[model samples]
Target: MWALRRAYNPLKRRGFCIGTSRACGAKSELGSCHLDEKASVGEAAQVIADRSLSLKRFYSTTGDSSKFFMGRRSFSSQAGAKSSGEVDDDLEDGFSELESPASAEAILESNAEDENEDELISEPEPSEGDDEDAAVEEPQNELELSDTETDVTEKRSPRKGVPSALFKAIVAAPGLSVHNVLDKWVEEGNDLTRAEISLAMLNLRKRRMYGRALQLSEWLESTKRLDFVERDYASRLDLIAKIRGLHTAEKYIEKIPKSLRGEVIYRTLLANCVSINNVKKAEEVFNKMKDLEFSITPFACNQLLLLYKRFDKKKIADVLLLMEKENVKPSLFTYRILIDTKGQSNDITGMDQIVETMKAEGIEPDINTQAVLAKHYVAGGLKEKAEAVLKEMEGGNLNGNRWACQALLPLYAGLGKADEVGRVWKVCESNPRFDECMAAIEAWGKLNKIEAAEAVFDRMLKTAKKLSSKHYSALLKVYINHKMLVKGKDLVKRMADSGCKIGPLTWDALVKLYVEAGELEKADSILQKAVQQSQMRPMFCSYMVIMDQYTNRGDIHNSEKMFHRMRQAGYMSRLRPFQSLIQAYINAKAPAYGIRERMKADNVFPNKALAGQLAQVDAFRRTAVSDLLD
Candidate 1:
């Protein structure tokens, strides 16, 4: 028996134990005692049961369970004494111990009972090496546990209007293919409502991510998820034109089914055309609407009316007559346009009749109507009537109406009523908008009250969080008008430092300052630098300033150079630049007849006033040459 114990001692170190009774009696003599396989199986079962209890105690004691389960699984596999089902059951018991409220002492007491029964099993205790391994692995286990807890918490918490998980998926979708994201979202058993898609599209549009918005709209349409209405289609079309160009918008419109081309879509396109001054396209759309028998709203008619008002006054009258023939009721905007047209033509009786007609139609005159009357009254030299109109507006709810106050300030300033300008300023100073502040500054500038203008400007800077280039330009003009050269230079420097994009107006004001201060070369240099640096095309005023300066100084070469640059820059659409050059040539005593030829080549015919000036210049040139010959 001692010899048998000595030979099997090596297997004992590997956790293989023989039952004491069986080993001493049956296996006392190696050949005489036969070992029972059933007894060995029973002994292995006892070893596994002892291991399971030790794991439970370890888990309960430390309240850290990963090590115990891992150790048990490894022990079972190495021993080959437990089935997978038994291992799984043991794992479940480990988990149950963790969830249970049994204290360390209670678990230890339960483990103590089994300790005596499994004495022959020799339950394993953790070694020094195992403790060190566990110490090293503790932090990693803690980190994984924390990460899992965070994921659970995030899933439990509510998100904003957008689901955080879905938003993250969408944002990350672009990194992958957008289609892949869409497919994954659909596969996740999630569905987006039409309103949700529309809101997402609008959010993208506001961020100027027009391409993304277009893509989302297309996706929604392709999936047959959204039944887009007329307004939605119109909005999409407008967005297409804004992001892509007019030509692309035209292509997109062509692709639209004829069934979807309704009045609203045409009206939206017509409005865009009007904004870009696309007269031919606007006419085509108007005619298309007429041919389609789309009920032409007054808004549509007014678009054409306003377009014609810019170039052909006769066409405006024709539009109104067509509207009457079509039986399209004129809106309040239509009546306002008529009043303004009559006012511009200086037909006061015509304006009054329109007002009466409006009132008879139950349309009370709005501020716009009163503004037109006041403007025409001022134009016709009826300042008293303009003042009465303003006083009447004041009697109504005029407070917080900064626009009316702005219009009145300029009229009072133009009439040289300094006291009235001050009164208007007092009424408008509270809650003044940017345009109102600008109007007040201009009025004070006209009244030659530089201090008052500066005060308004100072107040504007203090109250407003930001001022645009236009605001700075207006202030620069005030500084130049008052001959504050140092202050104007400082303003320019401050504008540059503050990173406000230097606009044409700012450049024009700065150049005017230099010209007023008798620095012609500096003015020209500044103008050139501004033209070079500005992303926008230089304004006609920028060119006119330097051209006038050079021509006045009899520098005809420089004047002609500047004029050619203006033409090359495609800014000669208006007649003002041509008039400036012709006047310059006449003043310089240079033969100015060629100016009329150039104007003709540019297809710019002289108006009555320009023709008279050209004729006078021609006569003066011939007379001077005839006298020299004599």
Candidate 2:
């Protein structure tokens, strides 16, 4: 009646359900024990005992345990005295059948006797090598290995080097397999604890071997027998993240218990969606985890910024919509990506709204932020606004920021603001790694402020101890533009003396300046030397300057020779030079000289327009004669 009552009870059925009884040979319940043929109670109890003992040992070996026995107290107490004795008999019978209880008892008893073993094993062991390589205390959840396992097993001898107390404690541990594996890992040169083991698995995942990493993580989970099932399942979920195979990774993730689903894995799937630029897929993944209120770490959320920054603008709206739906707060980098991309494309309209979004989100822009705005101002040709932004940056102590400074310098130079350029230079003087100084000096030269530029130039020269061609060329232009022609010439002499190869532009500037200043002799000398040093013909500008010099000095003879040479050299369409030549010839009062005799007998005479002008000159001679007659 009691077995019938217990069998019929729904709550008891779960625990009592078992295989077919031997006599019935078909499935039957405990209530049928009174039938003519049945297996004795003793035999039924034996199977239960055998299963319980095996499960207990298995759970003890690995670190897992279950609570199936917790709610069975009422059933155990209600059973008859005979059933009670049978249960105890079954427990002993299962233990004896598997292994000697004495040995198991001895293992358990010895550990309990030496309570000091707990204290010893609880302390951290040192690593191999000297004091320098000794292990440091790890963070919570970090794995640590035993010294004896790592050190003693290698020599197949006791490691006295390890403090005796720690070694003995490790040897005395009841779970021998646990002790051995820990020691073996140490012997194989790993001295990691559980927390460290997890970290190592994380490191392996970073190396892209997801399969191998998952196996290692599963092994760790099995061994640690983690009390928190979520932690184990989360780790396993992370390991399958890189599988590209069809549904393999997803299938594995689904196997994880509902309570164990990890946010990182969901985020990773979301990231994959973003990677393929599939915003819809990403939304689906996010929505599934929405009820869990899965919040991503800063590192994971940052990947969204990268994806948006790489893809075209069309995808940005979709990505933003997904983020909005998920309530995923965009990081500072997200705003930065938008600002930078928009700034680069010169899409100022987008930038305005982005800035407002950043402000509303309370994301403060850094130097990068200001630099992007500065770029927008530059590309749109808003020089004044660009300068204002740069000036505001300086007021905020950002002048030394290299990107902002580089952007600011060129803007000032473009506007020809020597005073502002000078101001930037003065501010740069205090710092050793000054980038603005050279740009500022070049700006000063462009403004024709040689004195102010020279002051900085000299300081940089003395302080820098070396000068590049850019510095030399800038200084040369300043000297020439300010009418310091002699000083400019001296610089050329110095370049020649120091074996520096002066380029054609610098030589052209020097020669043009001398010719402009009425120093034809100096100009000719420099031109001849430049030809020899450069081993190349002088520029057309050089020939033009020489021709102009001769024409201005009324040397029509030499001027015509150079003009013919220039025309032969293919510089023929020079109208102003031809006019200068005509003026020079008229001024020399050589109209009677045959045009053929003057221009190498080629009959290239002055045009018919000049014939009338020549007639006036002849009439002046006749008027002089008539005046004498009068």
Best-fitting candidate, scored by TM-score? 1
> What lDDT, from 0 to 1, does candidate 2 have?
0.44
* TM-scores for every candidate against the unseen true structure: 0.56, 0.30
CA shift of 344, model 1, Å? 4.1
For candidate 1, what's the RMSD? 42.2
Determine which window of 10 residues in candidate 2 has minimal summed lDDT. Answer: 132-141
lDDT of 2 by residue, 231-350 (tens): 455446534433332145567667766765666456545544443334334434644454355553332333444343432232233334334433556655556556655665556766
- Runs in model 1 deviating more than 4 A are 1-229, 236-245, 255-257, 276-296, 342-350, 400-403, 415-435, 480-485, 511-524, 544-563, 572-630
Residue lDDT tens for model 1, 282-351: 7667666656667766767766655544433333533553455456666666666666656655678667
Weakest lDDT window of 10 consecutive positions for candidate 1: 137-146
| Candidate 2 ranges beyond 4 A from true positions | 1-183, 186-191, 198-218, 225-239, 243-246, 276-280, 290-330, 367-630
